[model samples]
Structure formats: C-alpha cells, structure tokens
Target: MKKQTRAIASTLIFAMLLGVTACSKKNSNKSKKKFSVATQAETTEAPSETTESTTESTTETTTETTTEATSNPLGLKIDVPQENCEIQFLPEEERFKYDMVLELNEADHTVGGHVVVNFYNNSSEEWNQLCMRDYSSLFKEAHHDGFQEIEVKEGALTEVTNVMNETTSQALTCNRDADVSVLWIPLDQNLKPGEHMTLSYDFKATIPLVADRYGLSDGVYNVTNFYPILAVYEDGKGFSHEAYYNFGECFYSEISNYHVTLTLPEKMKLLSTGVENTPANADGKNTYTIEAPCVRDFVFCASENFKFFEDDYDGIHIRLVYDEAHPCGDTMDACAEASLQAAKDSFAAFNKAFGKYPYPEVDIVLAPIDAGGMEYPNLIICTVDAMYCLTNSYESFPYEQMAIVVAHELGHQWFMGIVGNNSGMEPWLDESFASYTEFVFYEYLGVEDEMELYSRETFDLTKEPWLTSMQANGILPINRSFYDFEDADSYILAAYSYGKIALYQMEEILGREAFHGILREYVHRNAFTNSTSSRFFGVLLECAGQDNADLNKLIEVLFDI
Candidate 1:
C-alpha cells in the first residue's frame, strides 16, 4: 500500500541495525517452483451484524471495562496463549475448506468457477444466513480507484446461483446488495455451533479491462478479491458489514485452506498465492493444481506474454513475472533484478525484525499497473514502466523508488498476510506498518542518507503535497475506517504517511532492540489472527511500560487517536 508519489533521491543508507547473517547463492532458475514449506493449520471466524462506522463492536470504548486477559488487563485483542509457538494454527475440525474448480477464458476475460465452501460454525451463536463481499461489482461502475485508469463497461458481476447445500443436497437462494458489495444468502436451516455445513455455488466473473488490481490490462489478468468470500462473523453482532471503498483496502476474512484446480489457456503464465504444481497442457489449455493452507485469501495474476526471471533466498524461491512487450518497456529485466534483490532484503530484514516468513515462494509481478503496488499473500504486483524503472543497483543506488514500493508490499507479507486485520476499519494496522517496514528496509540495508530523507519528510506531515489540510478535520485521523475518509488523498496521508511516522517515533522512544523484540512477540502471538490499532497500542505499552503514558499523549497530539 505505497503512495504513488515516492520519487525521493536515495543516496545514503543508515547502517543502524546489525547486519543479518545472509548467504546468497545465485542460480539461473525458472521459478524452481517449491511447495509445502509451511504447515497446514488454522481457520477464520464468520461475520456478525454491525454498523458501517469505523468503530465496530470488536474495537470499541472498553475504558469502562478491561479487556478479557490475564496479562492484558486492558483486554487487548492479542493475548499470549498458554502454549505459544512459531505457528499457532487452529485445529483441522475448526478450519474451513474451499474446494474450487475454475476455467479461465482468455479470449473473453471471463472465469467460470464452481466453488464449494465448507463452513464450520465456530461462533457461540447459530448462523441463520451467510454473508459475502462481491467486489467484482465495484469494477462495473463508471468510476474506479482514483489513481487507477479505469474502463468499467457493464460486465463485472455474476449473481451467486446454483447454490446448493452439499450436506443436504438442497438448493439455496441469495440476496444481493444493490448499493454495496455485501451479499446475504439466507440459510434454509440454522447452522448451530460445532456443526459443519457444506455449500457449493456456481459463479462467472468478468474481468474488466482496467489497470487495477482485479481487471484485465493489456494481455495480463489481475484476478484478486474476485470470489464470493465468506464475511467474518462476530459473536454478538451478525455478519460483519464491509462495503467496497475505492480509497483503501476493505477486505476482512478468516484464514482458511484453498484447494483449487484451474483450467486456462496454456500460453498464460500463472503466479498465485499458493504453491502451484506444474500444469498439464491439453487442447491448448493449461490446467494447474494449486494448494494454499492457512491463508486469508487466494489470488493470481496471469498473462500470456510474461517472461520469467528467478532467484532463491532463505530456501524460498523468488519468481519475477514481467510483461515487457506491450505497454511495458525493455527495462523490465533491470526492474526484475532490483525487485528480486529487494525481496531478498525484505525477507532477511523482516525475518530478523518480526519473524520468519511462513511460505515456500514469493512472486513479484512487474506489469504496467496504475498505482504504486498491490500485495497479496505470496504475489506482489508493481507497476514499473518507461519513466518508472530507475536503472541502478541496490548497493550504490541513486533513486531507490522501486525498492521502496517492493519493500512496502513485502512488508504486507508480515502485517497483512501473516498477521490479519480489518483493513476497512483499521488500515493503519497494516498499511502504516507496511510503510514503517520501508524504514526497516533502509535501516537493515544501511541506506543512511536515504533513510534520513524519507524519515524527515514522513515525520513532517505538511510536507506531503497530497495532504491538503493540516487541520484534524473532525474525523479520527489514524483510527478511522475507509468510509470515514472523504477522498483518497486524506486516506493516504493518514494511513500511509502519518501512521509510519508514529511507529518510528515509538522506536525512538523505546530503543530499536526493544522495539523489534516487541514486534517479533506481537507477530508470534497474533499470527493468523486479526489485530486492532488499540491492541497494537496495548502491546507497546504492555511491552515497554504501561506506567508511561507518552504513547497515549502522542496519539492525542499527532493522530488524535
């Protein structure tokens, strides 16, 4: 979630943190597709009824009563489990499963999918109806994300039809929200707690021709958030409500397992969130089998004219899929090399600073995307075309704009991918942390002058041209929801620019060693679970010292939290 306006000069690097022990062995490999590096565990919760406000029931005014925890008398979202491990996965019986079979039509830019979602009622209340987010409908409108170049011409939705209960073999009916992306499917029977229900449905998605995350640009197809995903259910509230906002990410879901078999044109190269097995070609079609366990969401970016460049770091294979022929220039090779090195640096730094990345592969897609960059689970799409690619090495780099974007997206691997959060509500939890990792990138790489320049402007919010006003504007600055922001510029200022500065100031308050150590603990405790900005504050105060009210005062002064 990088701001598109990052063309700062990159000369100096701060050798602040101690150098990590990294041994690189270069090998010219084509993806070298590796699979099954992470353990399969954990499932996510369903949704409950809540308003469209930024303050949901989960993160509310708990000042009157402490949060339910032993160490966390504040009752924060993160509570140290009795048996904490590197991977705290939910039991298989409690985990949800999505078995999908899809066929991609390259000619039509449409995907015909048959999805079977096996849901387990883990909540205290019985589920009467199921909810999902139809993000594809957002693309059909006349407008799109402000920064993105859009062409929305009608074909963007597929009503969830042929929904049948796999357990009882009963046909189902659904209700669609005309205004928002929320879809409500009334259940025939009440799915009680400890009960397992299997429902299958048929859907067809039309990939609009746009330079956005979920669209068809040139020959490349960015298929993301395109499915009818189950909304997270709260305990007291009904299914959580999240409308599609063009400003920031509004996706919220539980960690689940995906077993998918996709049939597409053989010429298209695929890069997805999971470990993909080699495809079998038949009748000019490539049918690939992919599996991703304990992931929040599944996405893939496919194209017919993608060239491959690859390298391996820390046993994880890194693949660079670039389309340099159409719309993209020839400097893609240089961008790939720089982007791969940044990926390696990101893995090393986040491994030491937070925790080890729990995946076998990472894919970097350098296409002609509109915005800065977008991050999925294992794949990241960065738009580095013509005037974009700064031909330079990572060590003595002059302009490190590409590396900053790549590092920010990779930072989501830890914040958004590994540790989950409600992006619509508390975007600062993920976007700002991702932005803060940019500083960690320079700090780890010892980009002293570059770090100084970036940190200076980031700390001074008025310097950013997008932030039109220095006033608070009556809205909760960093703590507000996506719907709260009037425009994209204000959202970027709060989530991207100001949020990272707050964390950096936190590091300055507590020495770097303590700060990094606390983050490592935070990720381990909250891995595969959703976190809140308040919980982050509680963790900081819990680790540093609750006696110090400096953080409380800082939030009041800076972000008006």
Candidate 2:
C-alpha cells in the first residue's frame, strides 16, 4: 500500500541531499567498475512454459495453438516475445506452477475455487511435509461468519495446523493469536532436492464487506491473497510461517505461471492481474480466463457499475475503471488522465534508469477507500480520497497527490514486481526505491519547486513533528522487519522516510547517472529473484569502488549494519 505522507517526507530528504557539500569530496574518486545499459534487442526472450489454447467466446470451444498464432481473441496482437514475456531467473527444473478455477457468487459475497500446483523441492534437504498459508483465516478472526467455509478437498491430505499454540512462549510478541495461517500437508513420500510433486485442493470463503485489500466494499469486489499460496521455503531456515501483520505486506513468493478462470455474473466488469483471454458466457454466469507468466501473485476486482476508459503509451495499454456516482467524478476523470500520463512518463524514465516493464498492459482503478493506494503486478488501486480532496474545493482536485501515488505504484512494477524482495522482512528495498522514483517523476516533469512545496506541507503535518517527538523517545533501526516497529507511524518513518533518505545519500556520493546505472544493472541481474540487503550493499560497494571508505561508512551508518 502507498504510504502517502511518507512519500512527501522522502522527497523532502532527497531535496536536502542536493545541498550536502561535504559528500562532494568523496565523489571525485570514481570507480573503475563497468556498467552498461541493456539494449532493446536484448529484451526479447521466449517463455519457459508451453502455451495452451482456450476458447474466448460464448460457445466454449477448445483449440490447440502456440503463442505464435497470428489472431488472438482480444484482437490485440500478442507481439511480446515468449522469453521476454516470462521470468528467466529460475531454472526450468526448479520452477513452480499454479492452475486455478474460481467461481464468484456476487449475491452471497463468496468465492469458491480449486487450484492444482506443481511444486519443486528446490531446497537442499529432504522434505517430509509442505506448508501453505491460509490468509483468509485472518479475516475470519474478525468477522467470524463472514470469512468462513475453507475446506481442503477430501482428496488432498492437508490439515490446519495449530503448531504455534503448542510451541511458542508468552513472551513472543508477533503472531501470538490462536488462529494459525499455516496449513501442513503431509507428504506420503520423502521428497528430495530437485524432485517435483503435484498437489491439489479446493477452497471457499465469504468475502468480508470491508474497505480493505481482500473484501467487498462499496459494491466492488476486491480479491487479493484470497487463495492458499505456497509459502517460501528457505534453504537453511525452513519454511517461512510468519503470521500476517496488520501494518505492512507480509507476503513472500516465487515467480510462477498462472492459469485462472473466474466464473461470475454476466453483467460484472472485471480487472485482473493477467491478460484476459477467451471468455464464455452460459446461462447467467460468465467464465473469464486469464493467463499470466512469472507473476508473484494474482488479484482481481469486479463491479457491475464501473465506468471504463482506455489509452496507450509507449506500446503499453493503460486503462482506468471507476464508479460513476462517486463524489469526485469529474475530478477523478481529470486525475485519471494526469495519473496515467505520470505513470507513462515515469515508465520511460525508469526504463532508461532501471529495466523495461515486460508486461503488455496496466490497469488503474479508483477504489472506495480513504487512504493512498495499493500495488499489484500490473494493477494499481488508488483510493477515492487520494484522487480528490474530500474537504477542499471541487475545482482544485488532489492531482499532485494522485500523481505521486500513481508514479510510486508504477515504480513497484520494477522494484517489487520484477525484482523481488521479502516485503515482511525488508520492505525498505521496495518502498524506498518507489519513493525515490517519485522524486525522479517530479524531476522529469521539471517541477521540483512544486514538489518541494508539497513535500514541505506533508512533512510539516506528519514527519517533521513526529521525528521531533520520537527523538526523545528513541527511534528504531531502519533496516528491520515490520514487526519491529511499534506502530504504523513508526513503520512509515523508518521504512519509507529514513529508507529513502539512505538511498538519496548514496545517490549524492555516486553521481545521478552512475547511481541510475548501478540500479539498472542490479535489476537486470536479479530480475524475478529475491534480493537481500547484503547483495544490494555489495553491488553498491563494487560500483563505488572498494577503496571508497567514505561511501561504505555512510552505508553502515544509514543501514545500521
């Protein structure tokens, strides 16, 4: 989710970095390390998985064809090369895949689905059992009957585990509740490294009517992390079974291919993570199929009253959907255009500085929420309040605020979406990069002065006073898990505010061009893989020159390592 005030605080700190003359002396000793920008010709690659053909119209017909087929159901050309379309970081032998079919009941506010997973035991040790997370339980805890009826189909040997209740002590602060998210599936055979296994299960849940990520709110159904996804299995550390925290994202998953079919009422409009393929309508229900490769997660939003608009920029299709009766209708239309333009402009800037966005389209939706925004792989959900100032005059909408949120979420398409990181552990890796990208957006627009004023106003209202108040209370280290923070405010301050400041300081030491070059190289090397703080620091040190003790010192101070 977008940390609205934190973005402004980060931009203000970046502006402060420009005036730090003391850091100029260390920059004269340039490193000899070479970094080259990737050419457009190098971006084309084939998908690692085989393509399957499916029917798209009302009559459900089946056909066998490759992605090279000239005509697609959507009438849009499938021109992105297969290799460039899918993530190439993982070896074919070690890749995991998911095939799911979901049916949505709009009247009951429920979803029923089944997923088949082909999982590879990539870890070195033999495994006796596997674990997956049941995030819907978190929602169930609050609205007892609302998020109910999750069954692991009779054929699957999976059961809910309450191991946390049995093993943990009272002193532990995180995830102390009785409802555990981990689901243990006993393996009939001991699976060794490089071995593959297939598992299938059925699940159903009632969507809560709340203004949160995974729920139904204001006549729109927002589905995210609703299905049971495989938990990350660390080589030496075992499966990560951390409970879902309330403040920040606690999700960590490997890039995988997805084939999802959602059956819903015929009149509902849908926006999902992947590209929509052949859709068929039968009786009162419509079946929509989507195929996405190399995405970490899949999500969708459906509403019968949504008004849709479309545009294209730099070979990427951009679309916006919103409720027509919204209080900020006129302003939202204007903000949507401005936000989409900002996103397109930022994409070009980021592609030059980092890496190209591999996806074919991006969907931006005006969701009914009171905060900033939320980011998915190729989709972004911006809150209504961020699109327009609710209390201010309608003539002057919150275009700048909406633009910052749009650019920030777009930045995640690279930092978090393409270059993966553990959000629960090191959220700064993505949030800080996203915040810095917002600064780049303003710089690209040549509105640094306007950004400064906006930043100052937000900083004054939130960070400026909070920092002074917390200075006496002692601040936590910036590089730590979300659980380490005392509250949402502390998390925002450390992860978003201080985190971007650290990057901006690093940018000051290395020139802007060199800094951008380093990030570009980093994204290229670590695309579709999880990155750690050590590897990030090592890359910086290598590019800045090992002999540059001052840069290392600054890193040590900022990251507290």
Candidate 3:
C-alpha cells in the first residue's frame, strides 16, 4: 500500500496501510542466547483447538498439491511436511460469526444496523466482560493532516440500543474507555475457555464527509470500521486495545465469519468483503445477502455513480468499480481499464507466488481515497488517481507503479487477510511483506525492470524523521507501534519502505527458491492464525539449516531482536 493525499499533485503513497506468518519447527540456527526466541510473541500463544473451519470460500489448497506439485510452482528444492490445521480449535467450537442487518440512507449519509455476534472463548484467558473497538467513536471531532482538513460533524456513533448477552438472557451494561471507542460489556456469566456466548446490539452512525477509509464523500460511502468489533484478547493481555492513531492501519482483529444483509437505496452499487448471494429489489430498496467466512473484518463501499467493469480469470470473478464522479472521466477511463487489467495480472502473479486466493470473487474499487490503496478480505479500495496523473491528463504515473499498488493491496490478502496480526503493534507484518510481494509480482512476470523500480521505492529511508531519532538511539527497529512514529511519512518509511528492503536482503541471503519455499510453508502452517515475528524467524532459521548467521544478523539489525 502507498500513501497519497486528498489532492493528486502531492501524490506520495507513503500512507500505505502496510500490513505476516511464521512456522513452527526447531530453534533458529542462532543459539538461545543469540536470538530472543523466548520473548517472541507467538512462542506461548495460538488460537483455539485444532478444528476444521466450515469455510464458505472455494479455495482448496492442500499441503500435498501446494508443496509437492510436480510443476514446481514454488521453486523450492526442499522436501516439506504435508500437514494441515496447525492451530488449536475444538471440534464443537464455532468460528467467530457476525450476523448484521444494515440499512444505508444516502440522503442523510447515515446507517442504522443491528449486529448479533456469536463467538467462543478461543484463548486460555477467561472472559468476565467483552472488549470491542468502536472505531466510529474515535472520530468525535475534526482532523488535519497538514495537507487536508477533514471537517467532521456528528460523525460518531450517535445511537446505540439493546446491548445484550443472549446466553443468560441478560441486558448488559456497555462501559466505555476514556475515548469512548473501546467498549467493555459485562458478561452475564464468566466465559471460560471453549465456552460460547451470543451478543446482540443495535447501532447508528452518521458518516462524515471525508475521503478516507471510514467516511462518505462525493456520494460514495466507505463504510469500514463503522461498527463495534471484538478486540483480540491476548492470553495475559486481556483485550488488545491500542489507541486509534491518525496514521497507518492500527486495526487488529480475529478471523471470523460474516453474514450481512444490507439494504441500500436503488441503484447503489455495493462492493463488499464477502461474496453476494443475490439481491431482492422492492419498494425502492435493494436488499443483498452476503456470506464471508474466515475473514478478519467485514466492510463495504457503495457508490451510485460508479462505472463498473468486470472479468473472470481462472474461475475467480474480478470487478472494478470506477467513480464516475471524478472530474476526469475520459482520462480516468484509460486508467480504469489499466487497473482492471492490473487486478487480473496481480491475481495471477500472487496466486503463483503465495497461494490461491480463497474467495471466489475479488473487487477492486477505484475511489477517491486519501491513501493509495487499502485492503479488505475480498475487496481493495484504490485511489482513482492510482493509475493516472490527474494534473497531466493522459500522462500517468508509470504503469508499473500503478500495477504495484494493485499488487501490494492484493498481497494483503495473503498477509493480513489470510494470516492475521495485531497491525497496530506490527504494521510491517502486512505492509512491508505486501511491499515484498510487489517485487514478487514483478519477478514472477519476469519484469526485472519493474522489479528494480519497485525495489528502489523503499530505498533511502534514513531521511525519514523517525530514522534520525532511531539512529540517535543506536537502533533501527522495524517493530514499531502506530503511536511510535513521528508522523505518517515516518511510519510509512519504516513499515512500508525499510521493512520491504529487509525482506529483500533476506531473500538475497536465503536464495529465492528457499525463501519462497519457507513462505509456502509459513502459509501452509499458519493460515488463519495471527502470525508472530519470532515464528517467522524460526521458520527461516530452520530452513536455512543449522548455520545461518546472515539471517540472524539481519533480524537483529532490522527488528533489534
């Protein structure tokens, strides 16, 4: 992901909502004293018991076919184990499930919805209360980004009703943090590990007129993070609650199932995270039913004036929603077509390099967003200016750069989408690796010039404001929280820029096939799990075989482990 601003001339996509996996095997070649394996976040943690997820997704990538395919899809020349379901989950347990019925009022830019979430205690920690992140509540006032001023009025969640825990048939008290964004609802009974609970609530929010990830602008609504979501619970940490920052993607979540029924005004084209079953239009409203399984978050964007384009490649349906509301329609047309083609090419490249995108369909919305691109489960929001230079009309950003944006966002499908993480704490797990996938996309297509160009994008990070302080402190740490950076540019530099180069450096040491094989193993082992840094390094050291000083030094230098 890149960071672009509200305007096109200042096109610096360094605002990439950068978004990781590790494998379990043996200790790294580096001795116990050499690497901080004991302090690694994933060492003592994993989600639930080993249970087969009843995924609605069409992807069926078996370990046998993925690792031992005769065609050598992943050029690794090593033998790998054939095992699935690495994480823990009980057979009777249910994956997190959210059932929502929402209605979008275009005239007032308001949405009224009721959500019923059914979930179990997957962690070892017992739950006396539930913690949730109400992102909409974070926008209580206006925000300024030096370049753009977002004037917000009544942008918060104005109304909430019927917060209940259905398990005990008890109405619950919804407590709020100081910011009023994190909700602490008292559970009627203690939710022990493996115990289930059902929560129901109704909410309403007025969408502010902002062109960012979670607002409405130019008649299009970016309805992301508009509802309260379950905050991930760490074993000893209770509920993970990082303050919402003005920069980077700080949202973290567990993979869950979504069944959303949305009602929209007539002619509103909906682009959402899950696949749509069908729609019934009646009484000037269109009601759509969608089912998304094993997804981190559920979001949807709607535009009544979108010029839509679609195509199918290898049974995966691709849709491109172009905002016709943009001033440069004819010029945007060429860029739109290019982006659609980029999506197809990106899917093909990533499917080969990583793993098959499990969802049957993927939607790329070309909207007027502040950032270059933001990713969801099956949908990606790209800046309409992503491909074209608005000021110069036909003259566009290098075609390869546009393709890289699409590829980077799609790469999140593997990093943040398939494998989960606490993004607020470890942005690079997704962002930097997505940046690496940008190189892999180009490399897979044999486009060395483009690969060289993309690799150079992360160069020269010392000039960023955050790096100077880091150098002064004598450490170059990539494991930074959203609040740790000096600004958006500094965060972008570290997470998106320097982090990718770190991976490239590792690839240089590990060899492409060996690294790719490790990645394949990582995905095969940790898919749908919140992967940790130590686990990733452990896999790398294990694959590099008993003696990889270069890999250890790189991790030490980049992450200060």
Candidate 4:
C-alpha cells in the first residue's frame, strides 16, 4: 500500500481517514453532537518563577473582553487559549489526551482557558492551523469556573494535562452564532523552527439527545463536533479555512503526534480514526488498540455488532463492515464494491494523473445514520439505505446505482481524501468533482451515454437559476449543508451535477488530454497540501495556456468569485 501519500489540498474536508462497517440496532444513527472536558492539577515545574507564585492559584480570575467575527457556517465555533497549553495523549486510551494544557505567561495571557490544538503536515514542509466555529455550550454548567493560571517562568515549558469537567452535552448553551471568550496557544512556541512537540489534553463529552445536525441517536455515536479541534491560522489572507460554507473545500492543520485511548463499555468494538495496532482484547472488557501519527483529531464509532468484510486492493488490505440486517444490504454491497473499485481506479489514475496512494489501507463502512456519506483519510462511511433511495429509484440495487454511488465515494479518495478540502466550507470543491468522477465509472464500464445521463440527472436538481449562487438555494458547506438535504440527493447534485458539468466543460475546452494533464499537474504539485478553488483554477488555467478562450470563459462562469 502506498501510504506515504502527500497532503490533500482542499479546505472543505472530512476528518482524518474514515473506516466503514455496519451494525444492527434500533437507531444506528451515529452521534454528531458532543461536548468534552478534562481536568488536571499542575505537577510539572513551571518554566519560570514570578512574584505571583505567592498568590493562591485558584484565587485570581483574569477578566478580558472577547471579540469574534461571525462565522459564515452557522454551527461551530473555535477558541484557543492564549496561555500556552501543554497537550498530552498516550497509546493506552481511546479518547484524546486532554482538552488543553495552559502555561500562562503574565505577558501572554488569554481571557479564560486556552483551546488545545493538534496539528498535522498533510504534505507540506510546515504545519497549518485549522479553524472552527465557537461552541460556548462548554462555558455554562461547568464544575470548574475557568482555568487556574500557572506561571511558566520565561523559556520554561509548563505542562497541564487539562480535562473537561463536562463529558457529555450537545449544542452549546450559547447560540450557534454567539461570540465567546477563547484563549489561543501559539504553536510557534519559542522553540526553534521545524521543531515538533506534543500538546495533549483530556475532555469528557456528553452525547446530545438530539444532535441538530450531528450527534447521537439512541446510544450510537454519530459524532463529528465532539471536541474543539484546532482551526487554521492564516499568515494574513484571512483564515485558511474557506470563506463560504460550500459543500467541499480545503483545510490546514498543525502536525503533531496523536496517542488516543478511549475507555468505554467492554461490549463495544471500536472502529476508530486510524489503523488499528492492537487486536481487540478482553480484560474483563473488550478493547481495540490504534496508533496514528501526525493526525489532527481522533474520531471513532462504536457499535455492538460490526459485520466485517475484508478484501485487498492492489496488495492493500481493505475492510468493509456493516450491519447485515440492514434493509439495503444487497445495494450496500454493490455500492461498496463499486466504491472500492473506484478508489483503486482513482489511485491508479492519480499515480498516472497525479501521484501515488498514500496509506496502507482504506476502510469503508456503512453508518446507520441518515446522512448519505462521510469521508475521512483512508476510510469513508456511507449511508447505504439512503444512498439506495437517492440514486436507485428502483427498490432494488441496479448495477448503475452501485457503480455511481461507489464511484462517488471512491472519488473522495482523490477529491476529498488525497486532495484534502474543508468539507465545512468549500463543499463544492471535492463533492462536485467527486460526483463527476463517480459518473465516469459508467464511461469506464462502456455504459451508453452514462456520463451524459448522469450529468442530466444531476443538473436537473440545480438547473433552477435560484439554486446557483443564491444563499437559500446555492450549495452550503458539507458539514452544515447536510441539514438542507433529506437523503443522498444533495451529494449527487453537488459532486456529479455541478462538479461534473464544470469538469466536463473544462475538458471540452482544453481537450480531454490537456484537461486531465492539468489535473495531474495540480495533484502532483499539491500532493498532500490543502488547496482552494482559486488555486485549482490557477493551475488549470496555466496548464490550458492562454490560447483557450472557451476554457477561460468556463473558468469565469464556474469559479470566478
């Protein structure tokens, strides 16, 4: 398996690699709404000593006004503690190490607690910061008022393995758009350039009863916004996170080591974020071990019954697990295979088109959730039943539906996974592209007019002028946009309809060879780095050269802001 892949370039992206499996339960919907908290008493020595040492640690409460710009996406919020927080994690547990570790410098203090951030180098030489919306629900109903400031003597590193006092809760008590005080800890710790360090923290998250957009249904974990993952930090061009909350986009993160240990009921088998290192074991309980390096955040889905189907593609081991009892089993399998094939095809194409596949394994699962599909690094979770309903109008699985959905999910390997976009903002970047590619599977299979038919089906949804560029009807970010969709319909429209149309148009103007050549060049250059629509257009325009007026016009109509 070519696991040494480069960083993806899109801001609108799914979390790290996603794995797929099916579980049988009343409500298989995974929990998306969650809140985490971890607490710790400082034991590590301060880097510096100050007169404040004589004062009671908990007695002082610093006050400062917090000003935050409204986020385009309405749901989440990101706040970083100014005081340097020492983050921690180990290989033994499942959840992340901590909420944050704060080393307060009287000179570099923040309003309250500093937000803990984990960074990763997708493919770039430097690490980028991720951006998130504010979730102030953490502030209210807290056992601890705020953080206890510790003086880090100049040049000394103070480590506080902080944990959240509140482990479970959904939706911030604060409004989604509300601005709250947050502390930011700079990764630019005075350490020399190119230096790496571990920032760990612990947090307790409550699975919300109703995860408005992303949360728990019944007891299953359909989680996404469980913790305060880091936000992208910009040099000057605003946040590296995307501007519009479109269906797909690129994201940035700081590179750091992740050692997550989650403690849960022994009856549960955890299908988590990265590849598994330790086999499931019983110590009066059952647990699986995982170790991922340079991951931004950890995500896991635990279910009692995970029907695992394992296979290998190009010598790379792939596992597809899901609930056998699901109504859409036959369709799911077909889609799964198609998706797998598409992924392999995309990888092969990328090698010729762009580069090589990065990781050793790719996992695809069928979540019992309502939303159709979600993509992570090597894993992707797609709602099989919903997928069946969205594209396969027939009650049964048709070869075409299987091919299209599978191809779409597989397309994520390039558009979303390898390219890396912020799914929260630029929904179209990867979705549309992936959709277009998904239909290409038909062409590959020698289906008649498959691309045209697929394009027509997709465009039919957004053909209305109101749907283009209008906030109410225009595409929304992947993360928040799912709300607007009832099933898998939106994905088809975004990925195949708009994205395919645009890509096909480009190919027409540039010639298939030249159009594909531009893609190859763009992917090769970006490899693992995060990118945006503008960047893609720039590269394509350059590849197409100045002689192509049609290409230029198409670029303007489709991508010009």
Top lDDT prediction, candidate number: 3
The better candidate by TM-score, 2 or 4, is 2
Worst 10 residues of 3 by lDDT: 17-26
Candidate with top TM-score is 3
Model 2 TM-score is 0.76
TM-score of 4: 0.58
**lDDT tens readout by residue for model 3, 46-165:** 321211221221334321233343343443444443322222221224468999999998777888799999998989988998998888876667866333355676576546679998
On TM-score, the stronger of 1 and 4 is 1
Sorted by lDDT (best first), the order is 3, 1, 2, 4
Give per-model CA RMSD: 10.5, 11.6, 10.3, 18.6
Give, for candidate 1, the lowest lDDT window spanning 10 residues: 34-43
TM-score, candidate 1, is 0.81
Candidate 3 C-alpha error for residue 253, in Å = 1.1
Whole-structure CA lDDT of model 3: 0.68
**Per-residue error at 252 for model 3, in Å?**
1.1
What lDDT tens digits, residue by residue, belong to model 1 across residues 228-330?
8899887898777776655468788888888999988888899887777779999989999987767889899898788888766654567888885754355
TM-score, candidate 3, is: 0.83
For model 3, state the Cα shift of residue 410 in Å. 0.6
Worst 10 residues of 4 by lDDT: 32-41
Error of 3 at 475 (Å): 7.4
